[model samples]
Target: MTPRSRPTAGGSTALPGTDFGHLTESTRPLVELDDAARIRSIRSERWIGYPQARSVLGHLETLLSWPDRQRMPNLLLLGSTNNGKSMIIEKFRRTHPPTSLSDREQIPVLCVQMPPEPSPSRFYLAVLAALGTPIRPHSRVPDLERQALMLLRATKVRMLIVDELHNVLAGRDNARREFLNMLRFLGNDLRIPLVGVGTRDAYLAIRTDPQLENRFAPMTLPTWTNTPQARSLMASFAASYPLRQPSHLASPEMTDYLLTRCEGTIGELSTLLTSAAVLAVDTGAEAITPGVLERTEYLGPTERRRQFERHLP
Candidate 1:
């Protein structure tokens, strides 16, 4: 028999065939590995694309190609914490990576996290830091602004993505107003699309400024529910793992249980599944069975909060 047809301990062949038809084409080869290797693979990070994420990526691509005008369009990517906002941006950034020319580096997409307590100077500093420029201590706000704008123009940044944008609300009223005005100035001055990413509070903050609210088109990534799409996502997750046997995670009963336990967030669901897959590999289950899920150690968001409160002094 050929090496591809040889049976492995996980009851799957080394390559794509009848025995490994349940898995993704790329994952089929992983099933033939030993338990330790399979466990390592299960713990590694991977992306599981879904419809919503794909739609967002498509929008981002459109934004990237938008022409520079007096009033460039913008996007507000709103979602709960631990949702896939950052990952989507990261993926987009990777797609259009920085180009190193003989003269200078050209960064088409610039992503920076909003300062926790945002001020004009602090925000400028964050931008400078993200661009790998050295910031002089005790620099004036005007100086910082000049440096940031110069670098942004020099680097030829096409899109600016500000993550944790809700942090703008953390400032006092005057500070918040100043920061919002600064955002407006940046968009107008650079004439590049600005993308804000944060929780719903980001939307609320933007609404306070009518001009910004109108300029930024809002997009949301809501929590998952028990539906055909959710089941399909679960099936994709199952197939991505290198398990020897089918996980059957898309069954109606299993889907409901998983969603209930995960509190309807893809991040938590991924955590739970990763743990279960690890347990499955370690315990010789070779699959994410119901029993394996039960044995897996995980805490849903609400339960974790309640447990923390219970232990409070």
Candidate 2:
């Protein structure tokens, strides 16, 4: 379904031309798919190796290869919610996936989510769950810890990534302190680097414990701005989609409008773009034009929350 282009008035190009040169070579063929297929392709998840994500991945690699030491270095990956912190960690984990040996599996990188209700027992349960161990209901905290640590050592996990770490603050004072202590104990016992991923609150929770605060170097993924890097990111996104014609999303005017509407978060920007791309395909626009974006049903995060509040009983 290649688009056809015709000369317009004043020597201008017409809409919906087969000028998919803007896309990556691998993605160019997708432009020929039917509208439903192209929309499905557009909705699929993909990675954009922007500079900040690359830098974070580099740091994760360094930590993964660090030699065993009494005080292993840790990292605190801080970012706004839905700003790509978890995506970066997932990408790193996939790069060094687990290896199954004759006897046992060797997990080079183990990722666990911090329990919403933070407690040592619940945390160890999360670890055990991630390791694919059967949970014993009503298991004692000590038993859970023993099992978790034993399995961690047996698997030879090089690094542990704890996502949603800001949930640590959800506990009471004593519970929080206990969880912090558990973290220190886990790191010291396993001699493996612990990476914490969450919002700024996670850093604050770490700061409460001086040792953890010192060990974990903070790295942040701030929201996007009207910068060259952001423009490049927009161009990358435009190329990733299977649109037949150029989106011109990297144009300064479009960049400004996108950043403003998406409220500067990559997650919001992605949602907005995906919705607009779907609309573009459905309406035969073949490119994400201003009209396509305007017709999308997507709403920015703030607006969605405000709308929700308005409907509250």
Per-candidate count of clashing residue pairs (backbone under 3 Å): 0, 0
The local lDDT score (0 to 100) that residue 1 gets in candidate 2 is 38
lDDT of 1 by residue, 27-99 (tens): 8878788767888888887788899999999999999899768999999999998878898889889999999
Write the residue-wise lDDT of candidate 2 on 1-313 in tens digits. 3356564554433446355689998888676666677788999988999999999999999998999889999999999988999889999999999999999999999999999977999999999999999999999999999999999999999999999999999999999999999999999999999999999999999999998999999999999999999999999999999887788899889999999999898988999999999988788787898988888998888998999999999
**TM-score attained by model 1:** 0.94
Which regions of candidate 2 fall more than 4 Å away from where they truly are?
A: 1-19
Clashes of 2: 0
Prediction RMSDs, each to the true structure: 3.2, 5.0
Candidate 2: deviation at residue 102, Å?
A: 1.3
As a whole number from 0 to 100, the lDDT of residue 190 in candidate 1 is 96
Residue 69 miss distance in model 1 (angstroms): 1.1
